[model samples]
Target: MSGETPLRVAFIGCGNIATRQHGPAFQTIPGVTIVAGCDLLPERAQAFTARFGGRPYTDLTTMLAAEQPDIVVVCTREDQHVEPTLAALEAGAHVLCEKIMAHTLAGGQAMLMAARRTSRLLGINYNYRFFPPLVTLKRLLTEGALGEIAFLSVTAHAFCFHHALDLLRWLGGEVVALTGQVSVAADPQVHYPVRCPDFVYVPSRAASVVVRFASGALGTLTATRYEHLTTRLLRLEVAGARGRLVVDGLTLDDIVGRLTRWPEGQEIPTGAGPERGFALSFQQADRAFVARVRGAETPAATGEDGYAVLLLERALVLAQTTGRTIALPSLTPVAEVGR
Candidate 1:
């Protein structure tokens, strides 16, 4: 919007994530304002207002009606996302929803359907896509510095299944079919040392997923919750026909021992800066939504993308449960969730 006024934004679900991540991130954008926030807990809402600079409310309906914000940030729990999101979209506001889109496929579908019916933009917060270093990796792969990505493998730690899924979709083309192996730990209370607030841990103790992309590339995404290995959890290896991107330690492997520079534009990270690197993607995601509202940049992962992630998550879970290979976007029908 070529310096047009800031878009008025309101947030729902003023919990740990809303107070910590999204609120601060939204403030960093040029044409966005975190005008108000709503939560069931008044104290939490007040805390969010104090920390994030927003008017507090205890009810979403009243907040939406009174504020009439241009954008609504839905930071509710994975299972609680649909209602508030649908209400926001139905009220003629664009939405940016948190990850794991929903707890069930039907829940995701409901949000997707509402956004489609309302014709309002519905963005999913796939924050890892906004990581500066990962952005550098994406540019390299897209520019063919890594020629024809062939095999992708992720040896990641706990609570980032969605990140791995989105990375696969970004680097490899559409997934055609997949088979996976999940190893559940003997103890039910096992926990990983993952520190991010936005990541909702999947119940599986350990997972190994094999995905086949339509572009004919085969990849594996694995997560291990072994106690000692959770701190450094984001190791990735994207081997292409030419070069490769190995992000465990942020190095490029192309048969040569190492490639230092990020092919001219690697060092200079664009968009939001590093002060919020812990939640870098959320800041960038907020920026993207505001840009779209102002007719500036196009958003990548929309509600459909969120639905796809939920489907992927569900497919993996179903795979683990039924001991069978699952096709993309296909699962046994079930009763609607959170109805």
Candidate 2:
């Protein structure tokens, strides 16, 4: 899109993610201009705009009408995602929403419907897919370098449950059946140096889910909030008929301290180190969304993808409650299942 008119971008919910990830990311992109920042708190909006080169607004409608942005980035909390995203699409802008999509499947469905009605691009920021090591691993799998997948395993802190779930579906084929169980901390004396706010913390301290994929591959995901070490926040391992791939030590500022491949005995180094790698993932994701908006071919997670993950979440909960294997329905023509 060189020499083309720069894409005007606005942001809703100028919080930590907006300030730390999206704002910095757009600044590095070539054909994007930050036009406005909107937040309920006037100071937050003002502060975000001051640093990101955008005007500030306290209301979404006013921001939409005034800026008429080509893209709206929804950085609000998970529950507040639908309203701003729908408004942005309806007001004639593509939308890139933060993760979790929404608090409920109904809300996610509404956002998807609005995007469909408006015919505007709707992207979800599943930034983990942009990690350099994971990106390389995906390419290897796509190229059949790792024959037929047999089993995949993921272990992470509870905070990464959603991301792990998305990875399972992305790397392993569509899920066919799943069962899950959750455990609470037995010792009431568990403490943290810094506690998350009530809204930020999910109550489940530990959980495990087993899933069977449509391709007959098996997968397991285990997450626990009980650990106090930062040596490794997330680890993913996939075994195939030919070989296996392992990615270890993913955190907010770091991803893939080590990436190992079997048989070949090769170790891939994820460049840029911890200080820059994880943040680079966000930049890469934003760049992909920008390329998609420019009518270029790029890989990005869509609204439908986010909705599918939510469906899996619902199925997992049901499985845990009923102590029965829950079968996941196909999400094709998501509009049909969205409702």
Question: Which candidate leads the pack in lDDT?
Answer: 2
Task: Compare the candidates by TM-score and give the number of the best one.
Answer: 2
Q: What is the lDDT of candidate 2?
A: 0.82
Global lDDT of model 1:
0.71
Q: Which stretches of candidate 2 lie over 4 Å from their true place?
A: 186-203, 269-275, 330-335
Could you give candidate 1's per-residue lDDT for residues 1-339 as a string of tens digits? 537676889999999888778888888787676889899999988988888776999988899999999999999877688799889999999998887677656667788888878888888888767656566667777788767778888866556666788878776767777788667678867754332232234534778889988888898988766623324546667787665666644211111112233233233333434243355566676777677767675535777677666666667766767788888746532223223
> TM-scores of all models?
0.84, 0.91
- In order, what lDDT does every prediction score? 0.71, 0.82
